[model samples]
Target: MKMKSRFDRNFDIINYTLLGILLFIVMYPLYFVIIASISDPNMVNAGKTLLWPRGITFEGYAKILEYKEIMVGYKNSIIYTFVGTIINLVVLIPASFALSRKELVGRKLFSALCLIAMYFSGGVVPLYLLIKNLGMFDTIWALVLPGAFSIYNMIICRSFFVGNVSEDLYESVKIDGGGYMRFFFSIVLPLSKAIIAVMCLYHALGHWNGYLSVLYYMRDPDKYNLQLILKNLTESISTKTLASEGMSTDYLADMQKLNEMVKFSTILIAALPMIILYPFVQKYFVTGVMIGSVKG
Candidate 1:
């Protein structure tokens, strides 16, 4: 018994060591970015700032906030993320539940169609033309509608339904004279917290980081999402044309560093809300994804 206990202790030590290494590998890059964002741009550019910041400055954050465009972009992104996630959930959850129901009429055909869309898409030009024809160009709907349904998320949710929601529960509900809507809302949805959380995280991140779709659909700069605005700002900084726009030499010099810092900082800021919230949601994702991936 004493030998077996020693073996278990050794195993635990090895396991913890491996876990610590993995954690460091994942965390170091993010830490490096944070430190670099606060350090002098020249230090960062010269690759001197890695583990710790040098010439620490909040000017980078200040410059990014001073831009009206960046502010507007933040507002637009928030609007898009909120509205888009709601639309996604509204469409995805019901669609997934419907798809999971074998008795639903034409279920197989609909599932096949959705799956086909995952592998093949109408080319970008065609999609752009369609959006233009639909008169959604330069509109917030242009960003929101095109991505309201993600087939991958739908499948994950459907799989969760198949695995976690036993048919016996549905049958029992039906025996009590419950219809699909009644059972779905009161029973299935309530029991699907984990999968729903996973879907929310997936959809929220997609909408938050999404910009190329907006770039294609939105022509007006006023309508630019956060990512697009940041892209433009980074471009302006890199090309050094920002100085030509009447910024003082001090501001310009600082702007150069500010630009570099903002580049990394905004990414950190943009991702921070979700990252902070993820731990709460992450507990659900593993179980959710696992259950969702299972066969009925």
Candidate 2:
């Protein structure tokens, strides 16, 4: 390679320096949280645990795991994420494939309608009543079925189907006497792995972290997802610990430590799944999102 000019060299140095600084700014808080979860809360509260863990401990995790409801929440979150993603894929693929076809009747009109729904929606009250009328309220269906289709995700799938898939493939299927159903299942579905993986990751992550739905429709604590359970625990910790009737002098310091730890630990616990899941889907995610952006 030819040697770069001084200007180019300086620009590269400046760009890298800026990017490195930005990366540190973004990553430090996450790093701090990870360390804080395992560190003694007294050190964290006193600002002594900033650069590295001052005192290591797992009291926070231990306390969090003591709740049986947390386990139930984990079970519910997993069920919701897996089942919900399956429904998302099953519903999205057919709709997207149909929409991707240029020869399909009312294609433009339907696409226009989908775009409109993205920009507009009825109020929360109307949505609640609709779910209630549909007999999905307080059930698992309420969590998964209401948000089964996302307009933005559907559009991405449609974009992939239209732009990435070759028209000649569909023509070949038709020439071979394959109908729409056979063509989609055999050709489009199999070839659309990247987009499907992208959709699955997005939908599954959203479902796993979902708490608002549980707060709104779910009256039963048994149905609470992990996020909701952790949220409640984090919120309740301060009040419940401070207001306990029989707290003596000796326990006060320990309760204070536990309370501080609970704050960081709750966030770490809730976010842990997504952090773990991202690396596995990252390659597919990149390809899927890139192709999904191709406009037809």
Candidate 3:
């Protein structure tokens, strides 16, 4: 390749400088949280810790880990995210694939129904009553089943199938003595990894971040997901700080600082899974989003 002119190099330098600043702006809050979680809560509360950790200590994390509900909450959250995402795909992918087929009878009608339902929902009270009547209340099914197949994801998957998957290949599969099942399992699905990854990320993030559904349907603390448990724990910080047994000024100040520090610790713990998961599927995620959005 020919070497760039001086103007091109100058423009490239300016672009990279702006991008670096933008990257830091987006990432600094996360970096601060990681450092703050391990730093002395008192120093954080005093605004003495900036750009670096101050009076580093692991006390906040140790306390959080020792809490009995923390592990249980983690277990439940993991189960919900994994199992829920699987079921969501099982329902969503097939429906989308079927709707994507121009040869299918009544496809348009079904697609219209999906679009209509996507735009409307029954009120929350009715939904709650239905869940209770079905005996899914306080159960894993309650969390996983309701809203399992999102019409939005279904539409994206259908678009991927229509725009990316070749109609001629599908017809050729039929000529080779294959049916819908064979084509889906052997051909279409194998070619649809990008969309699948995007759907999985969406559904997993929904389940992982879910707390309102748990609060509404499940009254038992033992059944609570991680988000709900951590939300409760974080809310209790004020109460605990105020209820500190010591009357000394130093003791009260320390309690306040510790509570603030623990907030960052809890957030870090809750977000760590998605942060780890994103990198593996990021390429497919970008491809799927672009194809599903900008393509037919």
Candidate 4:
């Protein structure tokens, strides 16, 4: 074993100190949000809910639960995200794998078209018109179908296939009298777990957080996803809390605290799924992204 010199020891100390500081800087906001969500909003606003929660309460969660639309929105969002991610994976994985093959006819042309579409698109007006013509406007299909697969993600998955999957394997499968379909289903997918995990995470996050499509195409309130619903609910809560006149000062103060608490709670609600999801796929994330990005 090599013994570290004084310079090496000093360097190690400095490096760990910097890393600890950086970790604190990155993590503090999330911690604060968590503490603030459960703490008395008055204490939070008064700058006293820094390291730990004070006057912890579940009232903010209770307030959110009182609204029935929030539950409906949660269900809708879950359905959209689940269905949309499945569509994305089904389209993206096969397309990416096909594109990674050199033997595919019109590969260059297809790749060129994808790149063009990724960089340029007919603006919102044309898309809206197309959706209307297809009779998909204000429909569930409107939320999940239009942007089912992302070209950029496809490129990444394709790169991953090219980099990680050996061409010799395909040749061996062909030698065994197995065709492309057999090779793809039985071989490619099982071996491409890292890239698949990465793509799933990416697409799931996109669908979960997405609201612009809902905002543009959805008109029926019941069909609204969680993001839009939460946004509107927050606004409605804020308006009712502040705009009501002739309420007692004590009542107003309580409403104000509830308003602040509601804000933090809603944020946590919106973000909780993604936060829970990331840890499960984290082991694959770095490997997939780095290898896919560096190769092809």
Candidate 5:
């Protein structure tokens, strides 16, 4: 190992110090939220719950668990995310592979048209009308089908295919009496694990966090996804806190405290899925993003 000079040692110390500070800056808020969610909200509001829980309680969690619709929302959100991501991959991967092929006629035109559509839309009104006409409104199809595939993701996948995938492999497959479908499933997909994982993560996050489509298309509360339900729950808490005119003072105070705790708890609940899922795919994410973006 090379021995560090005095100045080099000083530089290393400074670099580590700065990195440590940056880590704390990024992580502290999330840490604070975790503690706040369990702490007594009165202590949190009073700034007494800063490093640890002052009066630790799972009441916020208990309160949220009492809501029966949470399970329903979880089910609906899971279905939507799972189905939507599958639709995205089913459409995205094959289409991107096709575009990556030099043999595809008018490929440039097709790419250009896709880019145009990505930049432009017919706007929400026309899309809503179309969905209504197709009898997809108020249905799960309305949530998952409209934006099933993203052109930007397609571009990345195509770039990966063009740059990372070799022509020799295609030629070999062709000589072995294999068509595009065989080549795609047997060769391309197996080799494109990194990019595929990245796409799955991206699409899954989008589907899991999305609530705007539900707002626009869903008419029934039973069809609501988890994020939307949490959003409504937050709003309901705020409303109750604000409309405490006739309530006893002690009751009003309890509502206000519950409101604060619920806010933190809901945020954790809403984010927990992605947080758990990301670590599993994180190794492939950075590599895929870099290669896919740089290629083509």
Candidate 6:
């Protein structure tokens, strides 16, 4: 019994040690980014800052916030992310439910069409021209409309419904005279929390990080997303263009350093909301992915 106890103790130690190492591997990069963002850019370039910050300053954040463009960009990003996620959920939930039903007419053909779109896309120029023709250019709809339906997300959601939702329960509901909308609202949707949360996160993050779509569609600087504005800020800092625009040398130098810091800090800031929200939804994401991957 003593030998067996010792063996179990040793096994526990090994398991914990392995977990600790894995944790360090995952966390160190995030730590490094945080440190790098606060450390002096020269120190970062010199590889002197890793786990701890040196020459710490709030200048980066201050500069990023001081710019009117950055503020506007943040507001626009918030608006886009909120509105985009709502539209995504509204469309995706019904679409996924419809596709999950085997008895639905044209299911196979519709699924095939969606799958085909996953691989082939209309080229960028054509898509741009289409948006332009529709008079959606320079509008928030241009950013949100283009990505209303993600085929991959739809497939995952449909697969999750098939694997996780019991057809028996659905049939029982149907026999009780519960219609499609009623079953969806009362039964299927309630059980589909995991997949829905996962889809929301996926769609939200995509909209939040995406800048190319905004750059292509939006001509007005006021409509620029945070990422696009960040890109512009970086360019201005690097090229010393702010100085060329009649800024004082002292201000330019300070702005340049702050810009460098914010380049990394802004990424951390931009990513913070998702990072904080992910843990609550992470369990659902795991379950959803596992169920979605298994064939019914």
Instruction: Estimate the TM-score for candidate 6.
Output: 0.83
Per-residue lDDT tens digits for candidate 6, residues 10-87, read 999999999999999999988898888878987887788976899887666776677788779889999999999999
The 0-to-1 C-alpha lDDT of every candidate, in the order given, reads: 0.84, 0.86, 0.87, 0.88, 0.90, 0.84
Between which residue pairs do clashes occur in model 2? Answer: none
- Candidate 3 regions with alpha-carbon error over 4 angstroms: 1-14, 242-254
Across 172-263, the per-residue lDDT of candidate 1 in tens digits comes to 99999999999999999999987787788788888888889988888889889888987876687678754456778787776566667788
Candidate 6 error regions (>4 Å): 1-26, 39-48, 241-256
Residue range 1-296, candidate 5, lDDT tens digits: 98999999999999999999999999999899999999999899999988999899999899888888888999999999999999999999999999999889999899999989999999999999999999997799999998887998998999889987899999999999999999999999999988888898889888988899999999899999998999898888888788779989998887888888889988888788778877787887788668765955
Number of the top TM-score candidate: 5
* Model 3 C-alpha lDDT per residue in residues 1-296, reported as the tens digit of each score: 99999999999999999999999999999998988898887778777777899998888888778878988999999998889999999999998999999989999899899989888889899999999999998899999998898998888888888887898888999999999999999999999887888888889888999899999999889999999999899878877876777688888876776678778889898899879977896787777668767644
Supply the global lDDT for candidate 4. Answer: 0.88
Residue lDDT tens for model 4, 1-296: 99999999999999999999999999999999999999988889899999999999989889988878888889999998899999999999999999999889999999999999999999999999999899997788998888987898888888888877898999999999999999999999999887887888888788889899999999999989999998897888878986877999999887887789889888888889878877887876777669666854
**Candidate 4 residue runs with Cα over 4 Å from true position:** 1-3
lDDT of 6: 0.84
- The window of 10 residues in a row where model 4 has the poorest summed lDDT is 287-296
**Best-matching candidate per lDDT:** 5
Write down the TM-score of every candidate.
Answer: 0.85, 0.91, 0.91, 0.92, 0.94, 0.83
Count of backbone collisions within predicted model 1: 1
lDDT of 2 by residue, 25-141 (tens): 999999999998889887888888888987888888888788788889999999988899999888888998899899999999998998888898897899899988998877899
Which lDDT value does model 3 have at 41?
78
The clash count for each model shown is 1, 0, 0, 0, 0, 0
Between candidates 2 and 4, the lDDT winner: 4
